[model samples]
Target: MPEKKLNQKRKEFNKEKMVGIWSLVSLEVTDENGQKTYPMGEDATGFIMYHPEGYMSAQIMQSGRPQYASGEVLCGTQEEMAAASNGYLAYAGPYQVDEINKMVTHHMAVSLYPNWLGDTQPRYLDIKGDTLEITSQPVFFNGKEHNTKLIWKRVS
Candidate 1:
């Protein structure tokens, strides 16, 4: 192929690269004291997807969540429901990509945590072939402030 054609092809390829389903590899939280922790446990799991229509969805959960004794979806006691919610994180909304800056902003239209609704968060991104890493600004979680770094591998 001609040099110009090759360059154009590469650009197109890059644009489509971010649109796919990705599996979580790891999630790390760093505190002000430089201590690192995994809020979802060492074996946490999740998936994040970017659709062609400018929408995205992400879900993360701690491994081995407990089942409520009631067995019914809506019959869980307050404690059971709290445990389930505390172990999971999920949100979906339209997203904007700034490829030149290696950043993406997620506009949260729906979220498992009510406080996150209508929030727009910008995340720095580093994408290499099938792997993607995203880092966020400091966020207050369960009281203390921390920053998050998440690594994901393309699954589709």
Candidate 2:
């Protein structure tokens, strides 16, 4: 019944709850004026995976993206590249969960957006049933501060 042993046990239990593949249900953002918007369209599809070894990756893309005319990754026109980049997001890196604080920080080693690379993004976590809701700290998007809420359902 030692305190250190109890704390370690709790950490293990919490870590176990976080390891799995989660499918994106919704990604919503509420601006400073309290208007909600779906930045990735209403039917965006994505998945986030958490590994027991403390790594995670997330990729979310807006649905119905048009195919490139050239069908080549580097041959897309400027307009096509812009449209594709604007509607897609991907990042991967090591992640750490603070069970006591109810937060998870994703140490971004790489990201689609250059500014996000090498950033430690912390998200408040709230897990309910099969859903995991992660709320980001107020972030500036399109010139306004917004808090993004990503709801994920356990897939594995």
Tens-digit per-residue lDDT, 72-147, candidate 2: 9789999999999999999999999888667899999999999999999999888877888899999886899999
* Model 1 lDDT, residue 87, Cα: 100
Clashing pairs in 2: none
User: For residues 1-53, what per-residue lDDT tens digits would candidate 1 score against the true structure?
Assistant: 79887777557445467899999999999988888999999899999999988
Error of 2 at 126 (Å): 1.0
In candidate 2, stretches whose alpha carbon ends up further than 4 angstroms from where it belongs are 1-13, 140-144
TM-score winner among the candidates? 2
Ten-residue region with minimum lDDT total, candidate 2: 9-18
TM-score of model 2 vs. true structure:
0.88
Clash count for candidate 2 is 0
